[model samples]
Target: MQNRSLRADDWAAEALRKYSDMVYRLAYAQVRNRTDADDIFQEVFIRLVKSSPEFESDEHMKAWLIRVTVNCSKTMWLSSWKKRMVFWEDKDLNRIPAEEAPAGNEALEEALDSLPVKMRRVIHLFYYEEMSVDEIAEALSEKPSTIRSQLTRARKLLRKKLIGEEAKRRVQG
Candidate 1:
C-alpha cells in the first residue's frame, strides 16, 4: 500500500509538471482573472488526482483536461457568487509569451482579447492547442459544424480588427 501510494504521488507530480501551464492558460483565458484561474487550475488537478482516470494516449489525457477546464469555467460563471461579484479587469491577463502570439504582435493579442469567450476558446484551442475542429468540438461538447463556424467567424473578426488597426496607424502616421 505504501509503495502504491508513492507511485500515485509520483504520477500526480509528473502530470502536474507536464500540464500545469496548459491548464493555467486555459483557465486564465476562460476566467480572465488570475485568482479565479488559479482556483480552477487547482480544481482541475484535484479532480485528476481524485479520479485517477485511465487514458488511451497523451492526446486523450489532454482532451480530458480541456473538457474539465471548460466545464469548471462554465460552473464558475453559473455560480451565484460569481454572478454577483464585480470583476476587476486585469490588463496583463492576455499578455501571452512572444512565441504564442502571431509574430509576437500585441495588436493580435488585443484583438483576441476583444473576442467573445466562445470564439476566444475556439481560437485558443485551434491555434494554441493545435486541436482539429473535430477535437475542439469533442472537447467543447459542441458540434463540429458549430466549431467550424465559430472558427470562421473568429478569423473574420480578427482580420477586420487587425486591418482596421493597421489602417488607423497608417492614417495617423
Candidate 2:
C-alpha cells in the first residue's frame, strides 16, 4: 500500500511537470488574468491528486486535464466570490506574459484578448494547443458543429479587428 502511494505521488509529480505549462496557459487564456489562472492551475493538479484517476494513455491524460481546466475556469467564474469582486480595466493585468508571446505578435494577441472568453477558449485550443475541432468539442462539452462555428466566428472577428474589413476585401480583390 505504501509503495502504491509513493508511486502515485511520483506519477502526479511527473504529470504536473509534463503538463503544467499547458494547464497554466489554458487557464490564463480562459480567465484572462494571471492571478486567477494561477489559482485554476493549482486547483486542477489538486483535483488530479485527490481523484487519482488512471488514464489509459498520455492522450487520455491530456484530454482529462483539458476538461478539468475548462470546468475549473467555469466554476471560478460562477463562484460567488468572483461575482462580488470588482476588476478595474487594467491593461497590464490582462496582457499575456511577454516571454510567452512572440515578437510582432502583440497586435494579434491584443485581437485575441478582445475576443469573448468562449471564443478565446476555442481559439486557444485550436490554434495554440493544436487540438482538433472534435477534441475541443469533447473537452469543452460542446458539439463539433458548435466548436467549428466558434472557430469560424472567432477567426472572422479576429480578422476584422486585426485588419479592417476594407483591408480584407482589398486583399481578396
List clash counts for every candidate, in order. Answer: 0, 0
Off by over 4 Å in 1: 3-9, 80-104
Per-candidate TM vs. native?
Answer: 0.80, 0.82
**Top TM-score prediction, candidate number:** 2
Question: What is the per-residue lDDT of model 2 for residues 62-157, given as tens digits with 9 covering 90 to 100?
Answer: 999999999999888887674436666654654667887788777676787789889999999999999999999987789999999999999999
In the range 64-169, model 1's lDDT, one tens digit per residue, is 8999998887787787575436566744543455676578377776787788888888888888888899999998889999999999999999999999989988
Give lDDT per model, in order: 0.82, 0.86
Alpha-carbon RMSD to native, per candidate:
3.6, 4.2
Global Cα lDDT for candidate 2: 0.86
TM-score for candidate 2: 0.82
Which residue pairs overlap in candidate 2's backbone? none
